[model samples]
Target: MYELHTDRLTLRGWRDSDLEPWAAMNADPEVRKHLGDLLTREQTDASVARFQAEFEQRGYGWWAVEVRATGEFIGFAGLDRVDDGMPFSGVEIGWRLARTAWGKGYATEAALAVLAYGFDTLELSEILAVTTSTNMRSQAVMRRIGMTRDPADDFEDPEAPEGPLRPNVLFRRACGARV
Candidate 1:
């Protein structure tokens, strides 16, 4: 039942209705361009399951974002524990919206809200965001939300293959930092 609302969106728990669109978004080449290879339906289902479990166990995770006025599920934006073995270990804020939702400022809007939740409600000291070096779109969203990139924090993502997808950049904003 955890929910965070902004002027036009709601970030909340996943629902059975989200599965179809979630799978479609995962299967989209354009949307998956920075995220890696397109995922099979089964793979997408497994990811949704993991997201749901994280929320149940930790009270916060990647939330299913919807257009508040229409109740249309657009994507997800929220916090996640950075897996161990990454150069930087901490909570990271991330988003993946359907291509239709792109260019609408929804990512920045939801991210600002999630950042507030992390710093104010969760009292996290910092939040990080990572994307492949070439993903200018996501990097723009990171900057729009007041995160700064330090070149020294960039690294080869351990989980990605040794190529275009591996060279990743990290952006961060400390709690209470200007936004």
Candidate 2:
């Protein structure tokens, strides 16, 4: 298991024990608000199964974020490629945490670590983070990690309907930045 330990969080792959909590978080309205759609239990199972498969195939994927001290799963943060047609490709950092897990710096903290892994371990030249324009909270985190916007690189996300969230912001940060 490739597990990353931060001061307050643990980034790791999924486990059988994580199913129930993962389902609850996916079903949480607040957590799914910005995620485009809320996943039903069956969908959540399929999602987790896909995540597991991706990890086995690619050696990495979205990692489950847990508070090491309390052993509580907050959400997930890691690198994923946009499956929808887009202009660029490679690892892109992302996060989805329960509402209760927000307001803390966990997203920023975990993302920075993933950025480091992308540039160092994965040897990626650049990593992108995309979020709907209206998702100011996520945009702030992208900026917090020192990623700059590339307007010319913006592309329509096939998964997103036309709206504020549809106008995706592409934040790019190269290697050499602090993780």
Candidate 3:
């Protein structure tokens, strides 16, 4: 298993045991607020399978995030190719955590590690992060990890429902740039 570690967390591959809590995290309304609809167990399990396949095919994908001390599966954080049909295309960094994992600096820590791996290990020229205009939490994480945004880069997400989540913003951090 490929694993990336931080002082307090571990980013690694999926496991059969992750299904239950992963499903519960996706089912949380607050967690789904910026993410859209709650995902069914089947939907989440399929996502896990898809994520695993991404690792097999691409050597990198969303890694299952967990606490180092307690071995708690809190969420996921990793680098991924931009989804097809987006306004721009490049590798992107993302993180999602259970409610219990919120407000603890875990997202920031995991994201910093992801950015380092994307830029240093993978040698990507730049990394981006996209989120709904309303997702201040994720946006804040982007800023904390030294990604920058130009309001001019904001765009409408054609794939999002015709609502709040439809409007998206793009944040970028180029190689050799400092915050």
Candidate 4:
């Protein structure tokens, strides 16, 4: 039920209308490039179900992002618990947008809002972000939100198939650190 608002975007709960566009976004090879294989519609729907459940249980999770003016479902952005087998444990920040939404600063705006909520509302001491080494776009957003990376923190992602996505980078932003 948690939601966020920005000048041009709304970070809100998932809706029935979001499924189609969400599936399409997941199917985008460019969007899923750093991420592994493209997701099928069933996989996409299952993921959304999980996201919704997580939000209900924790009061925060991947938010369905929409353009406030046009009401277009662009993608999702929010906080989630780091998966169990990752080298590190803590909340992680992430976002995924349709190609149409790229280069428009939506990720940065939504991410900044997520960080503020994590620090001010949830009172967390830190937040983390992980991405493939080649995911410069996400890395830029991480840096813009004041997350700092230590090369020592990088790891091989167990989830990624043996490929470019395996060598992952970890970035951290302590509470109160802001860009």
- Among all windows of ten consecutive residues in candidate 1, which has the lowest summed lDDT? 52-61
For candidate 3, give the lDDT. 0.94
Off by over 4 Å in 1: none
What are the runs in model 4 whose C-alpha is more than 4 Å off?
Answer: none
Candidate 3: C-alpha RMSD to true structure equals: 0.8
Error of 1 at 109 (Å): 0.6
Alpha carbon lDDT of each predicted model: 0.94, 0.83, 0.94, 0.94
RMSD of each: 0.8, 1.5, 0.8, 0.7
The residue pairs found clashing in candidate 2 are: none
lDDT of 1 at 91: 96
Worst 10 residues of 3 by lDDT: 113-122
> What would the C-alpha RMSD of candidate 1 be, to one decimal place?
0.8
lDDT, candidate 1, 45-69, per-residue tens: 9999999998889978999999999
TM-score, each model? 0.98, 0.93, 0.98, 0.98
- Tell me the tens digit of each residue's lDDT in model 3 across 52-126: 999899878999999999999999999899989999999999999999999999999999888888888889999
